[model samples]
Target chain A: MSNTFLIILFVLIGGGLFLSFLRLILGRKATDRAVALDTTTLITTGFLVLVAFLQGRSMLLDVALVYSVLSFLGVLAIARYLDGGLR
Target chain B: MSFMNILAHVVTGLGALVLFASGLGVFRMPDVFNKMHAGTKATTLGSVLFLFGLGLFEPSWLPKLFLIILFIVLTNPVSSHALARAAHNEPSEKPDNLIIDDLEESKGGDQ
Candidate 1:
């Protein structure tokens, strides 16, 4: 039962990643791409957590945390830059 | 097989579904702001739910999972707000059906 559940979870997340990637590629504007990128980062973070859960390893949790923090910073920087910065 | 196992599976499955919804919304929404609305809020909730479910699966990993959730809660809004402001500043990304122009008027006085 647990194995079936994990497979379903992976399929769902992969679909999300694929759709967001589609958006990233087809987005017309810079902001559209940025929004897609943000969604992808968030999904990736969750994926990392799920992987860690499956592996029963604590270290992967730290990796996921760091990945999220860095992605947050990246998205913030992109948003501020696009906002035109202290105009 | 166990009660906790079943609960974890259900919660995680739901979280995955919510994440899928967020992606769909981002793909289908008409404009940048609409996409941000779905991407930001849904992604935050979905991630939190997934992390909580994982924590349930392994009791020992609870603290760090909570830490991840805390970071997500704090940063998701800030990033989304910044993105919204950016989208507003760029007239090209503005939604077509937006009836109110309050932000346009406020922008001059506020910033």
Candidate 2:
């Protein structure tokens, strides 16, 4: 990827992350915050992958992959807890 | 410079834009269920397209990107559903605009 393209991608995802954070804090309910967190994690994974391209490193892809999996697990746990299913 | 490079740039740019839209949806939507819909559907697509474009730029990294994309696609909707269901079951905090709740109708005993 070109340097300019990388910059644009960074700005776009950064804006996305910022908005997601806004939603997280402004959320009225725990479920709303959870959904915002899920969105944030998803955007973060995409950002990480874009950074991998910028840095030209395959190792970063592994980090993104693992991070995505971990976040999904966390979302699941939060969902179960919210529903009173975990108890 | 080349056709392939331009393809990567356009695709990646558009993908990131979609992610931004998803965030906007989460922020501007009226209720939690609507926020879940926007956040999950659009972000799932944005991540897939963003990674696909990235893979086009660097073919060697495509495999790992594919893995991450698949994981996002499979998990996103499921997690959204779980969250929505959890929210719906909260009798005190029902969404104000929830229309025609069939789940509470068909299976009302549990809730």
Question: Which is the leading candidate under lDDT?
Answer: 1
Classify candidate 1 by CAPRI docking class.
Answer: high
Per-residue lDDT of model 1, residues B1-111, tens digit only = 899988987888889999999999999998898899989999999999888988888889999999999999999999899898888888777666888888888888887
Model 2 misplaced regions, further than 4 Å: B109-111
Which portions of model 1 show Cα errors greater than 4 Å? B108-111
What are the Cα lDDT values of the candidates?
A: 0.89, 0.87
TM-score of each candidate's B chain against the true B chain: 0.90, 0.91
lDDT of 2 at B84: 84
Clashing residue pairs, candidate 2?
Answer: none
Cα lDDT tens digits, model 1, A1-87, are 367877889898999988998999999889999999999999999999888877777899999999999999998899888988766
- At residue A20, what lDDT does model 1 achieve? 90
